[model samples]
Structures are given as structure tokens and as C-alpha cells.
Target: MSNYSYPKLFLFCIGGTGSRVLKALTFLMAAGVDIKASQIIPIIIDPDRANGDVTRTIEILNKYRDVRSKLEFDRNKFFNAEFQTLNSLDVATGEGKEVGSTTAEGFRFGIDGTKEGRFKDFIAFDKLQGANRALLSALFTEENLDAELKAGFKGNPHMGSVVLNRFSESEDFNFFASRFSQNDRVFIVSSIFGGTGAAGFPLLVKNIRSPRTSLRNPEWIKNARLGAITVKPYFGVKQVDDSKINSGTFISKTKAALEYYHSNITGNNSLNALYYLGDTLTLDYNYNEGEMGQKNMAHLIEFLGAMAVIDFMGLEDHSLVTEDSKAINPIYKEYGLNGDVKTVTVKNLGRQTRNRVFKPLTQYTYSYLYWSRNLSSFPSNQPWTKGFDDSFLTSQFFDDDLRQFNRRYEEWLNEMGLNERGLKLFRLDMGHGLLHQVIEGIKHRKKGLFAKERWSFSEFEGYLNSVDGKVRATALPALFMELFYMATEKIFDDRIPNSN
Candidate 1:
């Protein structure tokens, strides 16, 4: 209904873990979860160009953009926040120097000269002679030297730290600095056990906290309210022969990263808020060093990590005090549930988490189910149609963009519901008793003892017919979204108990 009025939030997602967390964040936004930031600028920093997880997330983001661009953010707040890329913004560094054009497409940030070749080649190992060569050999194993750069660091944080140290000099960081205003905030998502995330998190923070003179708006860049979520080991991978990645090393790697962070990040108050999330009941996924085979399922930890982003943005500015580019009172946070169960429901979540997510998710679930079930059956002659025909329903807006978004949304829920420590929020397999048994533990409240206990698809259509005129969109796609948003909101308020 209205445009963004709040400040932008630059979200820096690093590595495979980062990509998964961002995917969770995107689904949460689609479900109309309240994120205080008006615009989210996702800067994905991953070297594995062919990573399936990253590829899938990028596809979802592009589809989200296409779908949300067609509809207004009405009362239901579905896809209300705006997202932008670094190149899309108007940016210039110090002395009117423009940031160089990037080679990375979409939301990714390309590291320099990493497109092809070996790790030894990237560092110019052949050029070294005598002690220099010997020192390099001492530092890196033969396998490390031969590791493919494109396949990622393969759990080698040492390699990642060296490779990612140049992040400050990247064009993407410069563009981000130029576009940043004083009120804008930054949040980083990474993992402590892996290569890219473990190394990139500290290096990225160092660059932001101590900006170079070449960067535009250096003071604002240095003093901005910063937050981050560092995911610990929550999943493992199957043992593969001759693979550089090893699940047995995760705990040791995490411990090392935590020590380094304590000295350089938390000890010096580098961030305003730091959120930590992990689980011991890990799921074993098929191992691929990187590339297309690296896709992993959605986990409860990633979902909670996304919630950390929302919580960070919602904090009061005064709580995050900074003096000369250093936080005065940095906050550390961890997530917990009301009960530790194998299958999670809305009621099992902590009160704050439940209050923030349950209602919005339920409303969107209702909208999705209703539209998926009844969209084709609506009479073309209804007043709500405005004389539109079946062609409008079959247009690209509905047939392509909306359809793809719906499919992905449904898959995300299913993935989380089937993963270890599953978040079983809804019973998606049901065909009947939708209003009464769709949600895992919550249900619609009946009007009276004698009245119908649950509403059928016919009753849902009747409610739609009653409210279609109230939606104020002229375009068919916008009208369609508005109708569902309004109907779901009303249905949630009138029928769903304990929704407040």
C-alpha cells in the first residue's frame, strides 16, 4: 500500500551456510514476517560459483523480485520489503571515482582472479624461490597446493583467510560503502566450522570497522550499527574417498574460529550484536567438495539464523552504542525453544519467536492453500473478475512467476519439515478438514456448538466473493494477491484462536 520509509539493511551472506540462511530469510519475508528494515541489499559472498545451494537461492530471489514487483504491499504485508543489487544503486567512492564494474552476476560478489586455476597458481607459488618456497610448503600441504580454487577451500579456513583478506579492496565493498547512509545497518551471516564463512566473517568485519580513505562515507562505514550470526556445526556429510572436507574436523575448526573471534572481534567490540546458533543432532548429507552437488536441505538452525537478522534490525539504536568505531555495549544472543521435541510446532517455539512468526506464517499458508486449491474454479463472470477471462488467469504473471514462487515456498516448508529436528508447522498432505487440521497443533474456532465446525472450500469461496470488492488494485495480478491477502487476514482474525 505504501513505499519504504525506513533505512536500508545491507545483508552480507558468506559461503554455503550463508546462502542457506538467506534462503530461509527470503521465505520468511514471503510469509509476511515483520522485518524492521524497509530495503534489504543482499550481498552474497561465495567463491563456489556452481554451488547448487547458492544457485537455487539466487533463482528464488529473482523470482521473488519478479512476483513482488507486480503487487502492492497491502494489509497482509506479503513481500513488503524491497531488495536491490550493488550495481543497481547509484554509487561513487572518494574523489568522484566510480566503483569498477563487477564480473559477478545477480547478488554474488566475485573475488578477484578466482574464476579458474589452482590454489598454488592463485598465490603465485611457482614464482617463489628458496626459503620463500620452503615457507610456502611448510604452510600448505601438497593437497592444498593442488586444490581447485573453483571448488572452494574444502574446509580449509587457513586458505580461506588468506584468499578472503583482500575483501576490503573489492569493488563490491566500495559500491556498498558509497551507497551507505548513517542510518543504514549491516548484518553478516556465516558459519564457524567451514572454510569461506569462518575466514570471511572476521576479514569482512575488519574491513567495515576500519575503512580505507579511498572508500566513500568512511566515517559512516566505520561507525554503522553492525550485527552477525555465526552458525556452528549442525549438519555433517558422508565420508568420501580422498575428499579434503572432513566432518571429523568440524569441532576443532569451530573451536579455533571461536578463539580467533574472541581475540579480534568480540574482545575489541567489533560488532554491536552477535548471534550464535547450532544443534548437536546433526543430519548427514551426501558430500561434494563444492559445485552443483553441494546442495543441503533446510535446517532449523538456518531458520533461527534468519530470525537473528530480523531481531538485529528491530533493536533500538541506543542499545547499540558506538564510540570511535567501537561498540560500547555489544550484545550476545542465542535461541531456545519452549520444549525440545523431535517435531516442532508453533506452540513449541519460545514466546518471542512464536509472537513474531506464527500469525504471519499461518496467514500466508492459508493464502497459498486457498489459491492453489481454488484459483481455477472461480467463475469468470463474478463481479470480482471485472469481466476478465481465463486468459488473464493463465497470463505470465500467474502462470510463471507466481506459480514458481508458490512451488518453491511449498518446497521450503516441506524441506524444513522433513529435516532433522523438523519444524512441522503445517500438515500439507491433508485434502479435507483444512481449517480444523491444517496447522500442526492450532485450528480454527467454530462459531457455535451447533454450527459447522470447519469451513470447506465452498465457504472459503463465499468469503472471497464477499471481500473481492474491497481490494483496490486495477491489474489482475495485483488484484489477485490483494484478494488472498485480505481474505487470509480476515480468516485468521475471525476463525484462528490465540492468534494474538
Candidate 2:
């Protein structure tokens, strides 16, 4: 590969699932997983203003931005990717004032008269002609036409289709198009079984690839390297008394969606690459159409979906687009394990997938666990954590920000482990001897007595001290992360399985 700068990746996260999976991708990127992009811009689209999952994801993204801004970036490979929002991009480029509110307020085109009225009133059904009213009545039921238009579409794709079709005319869309360059790429994430995602995915892609006379770089945006991952239903929900969502309808909805994609999306070559992932082994969550009740456990499928984004970024530009600026025999991918196992481990993953994720993930998780469990025991004289009052380890740098982020990261992994098709990569409950327990069956590897004795706090401190001269001396966050990377790589090299 040449030594040229990488292009920016524009990620359009379409709904609740999209937001959650973006959160997972953020954590993986922070841990030094290689994604072939210079920067990433995440745009979340969801009409549910009070969605718990989207809210939490925005909070984490903000915190990540704050922490990354304070670190040095000379030769850093981790936490070096730039993240931007449409509003921020507008300000940075001096295009205009902020186009929209923050991600927490949700992304939706303004409906002029729908805040305190029924959908029928907002659409002016009474003013339509006789034949038009009859046609509208044939397409939508009374409940669908008269439902309130404030909260969301209520798991109804038909309603979402009508509401979200106006997205291209919005100010945010204009700002995004203005900043898009010919070298940049776009990837979208959505769920085929939900309301906003099912409807928004195709609509957004259509607008991107459509010819627009108003936009500045319509042709560039149209022919940009495009990829998408449409998640099938992997989990169900228990039935509730008056719930608008029914888990029983997931399969039927997915079938309908696949048929639509076969006709309009895949056959027409709308996307350059597509990925599909779902599981037969699913866990039933509580029924929630939107809002606070919709917070879900992290799943293995979302992590794999995020991996699909990385895989897409790694593809060559020629592999995605032809000389004529059309999709060139677009690639389709699906994720799978090497063996049938209820509890997935590093050994169970395919060789290529394991090689990409296992070592980085393990190193990050182990370093976090070690610090959380045994930080007080490290000597105060060490170069990495020295100084009585000015040490980064003792200051709020670690206690306030890094510590809390590490706990959330551990919780995310633990939630995935407890869910269906469990990803049991680490033992989070143990305090003593936790480093050796990072991977299952790691302790049984044949090693000398000195190797076994090396899994101690003193050994970790010594490893950190030994790397002081090798790495560039920088800020506390950079030094701390470098130490963890060196320590974990050295300690786990012999015991961890070699890539096939």
C-alpha cells in the first residue's frame, strides 16, 4: 500500500440498533482495532426523542471525543480516528449556522402541523378530493392514518415511509452533501425488522445515489463507495397488553423486507457491498415500542455487524466501483463461526476474524481489568504513575473519566456474554489471577514456573517501566495506554493461540 492519507468514512446509523452497534464500534476503535479510514462521521436517524439506547450512545460518543482531544497523536494508533456530526461539520467548514440539534434531540424532518394533532389532520385528509381520499383509505387503515405523529411510527414501516421520505430536503442533508468529497465513502447500518430502520435505509440510500440539481456535489455523492449492513431479527419480545410491537411478526416482516430489497436494492445495484447477519438462538426482551423501556442488552450479532463495517472499509476502491462509476459485481457477506458452540470463545471464531479482533480485544480488556482490580498496589516511584499529587493515575483523569469508561466497557462485554450465543471471552467476576483468565483454556498452556509467576502486579509494573525508553514520552493518557499495550502484548504472547 502507498503512504497516502486514508479517506473519511461517513457512517449513517439508521435507528436504535444502528446507534447501539455504533457504540460497540467506537469501543473497538478505541482499543486499537484497525479500520482503514482517516476519520469517521456518524449520523444517527431516529424519531424517538426519548430513546434510552440512542441517548446513552450519544453520551458515550461525547465522552470519547473529550478524552481523545487531550491525547497526543504523533504515532498513536489507538483513539486517533476523528468523529464529527453534521452540525459540527457545518460549523467547521463555515457553511452556515448549526443545521440541527444534537444527536440526543433525534433526527427528523420538521412536520409543520403535527405536534398536537392526529396524522390525518396533519395530512389534511379532509381537504383531499374524493378519489384521492378513497385511494389513501385503501392503502392505510383507520388506526394507521389517525395515529399521533409525535413519538414515532410505532413499529409501522408504512407510516415511517411517508414521514422519512422528506429527509433529502432537510437542511442536515444539504450540509452533509456540501462536506462530502469524492474520496470519502459511506456505510449504513439498519435493522430490517423495525419501523424507522426498515423504511429509512432504502430511502437514505436512494437519496444519496439520486441525481440532485440543488446540491453542490451530487455526482460525487452518487458514485461514492457505498456499503451497508441490514440486520435480520435476532431477538424477540414478550407480548404486552397494549403494545404496538409484536415479536411474532418479526419473521413475516423480515421476509417482506427481503423481497423488497431483492426487487429494488440488490437487483438495481444500489449498494456496492451488503452484509446480512441474524441468529436462530435469540433471547426474548421486554416489549417496548420506544423510549426508556427499549434499552437492550448488548449482543454478539451487533459486534459482528460492526466488524462488517471494518471489513467494508478494508476493501479496495476498485473492488467496489467500476470505471463507469457503477457497482462492480457487488460483494455480499455473512458472518459465521468455525464450530458449533453455545459459548463462543477466541478458539471458536474463524481464523481471519479471530486474527483481526481477538488479540486487540483481549489486550484492552485485560489491561482494564488489571487496573480496576490492582491499581493501588503499584509502587508510587514508577515512571508511568509517579508523583504524589500530580500523577495521572491518582488524579481525576483516571478516577473520573477512564475508570468510568472502563467499567462501562466491562459491562458491555459481560452483557454480551450473558446473552444468546454468548461471547465468553473474559472472566469479569474474578479479582485475583484475572490476567491468566482472560481467555478460556489459557491457563492450561504448557509454560515454565517463571511464566506462571510473572502474572503479578510487580511484573506488570516492571513491564511498564521497561518500555519508558522505547516509546515517545508524552501526556499521561498516551503513556498509560502505551504501557498497557506493551505489557499485555508481552505477557500474553506465549499463551495466546497463533493466527492460522
What are the C-alpha RMSDs, in order, of all predicted structures? 2.0, 3.4
lDDT of 1 at 408: 85
Worst 10 residues of 1 by lDDT: 91-100
In candidate 1, stretches whose alpha carbon ends up further than 4 angstroms from where it belongs are 1-3, 92-101, 381-388
Predicted candidate 1 versus true structure: per-residue lDDT over 1-500, tens digit per residue: 23455668999999999999999999888888888886898999888889888999999898888988888765447877677776676653345345656554679987886778898998899999999999999999999898888888879888988888878887777778888877889999999999999989999999999999788788888899999999999998889797678899999999989999999999999999999999888888887888998888888888899999999988998998777889989999998877878878888888888888887888788778876776675575555556467786678887788788889889889988988878888877777455657788875787656666577665666667778779887777778878777777777777778752
TM-score winner: 1
Assess each prediction's global lDDT (C-alpha) against the native.
0.84, 0.74
Best by lDDT: 1
What local lDDT score does residue 429 receive in model 1, on the 0 to 100 scale?
74
Model 2 misplacement above 4 A: 1-4, 74-76, 90-118, 126-129, 146-150, 322-325, 381-383, 387-396, 443-454
* TM-score of model 2 (CA atoms): 0.90
lDDT of 2 by residue, 391-493 (tens): 6566666767677677778878988899888878778776465455557645534457654532555556666677666666377677666667776766557
How many pairs in model 2 have backbone atoms within 3 A of each other, for residues 3 or more apart or on separate chains, i.e. clashes? 0
Weakest lDDT window of 10 consecutive positions for candidate 2: 102-111
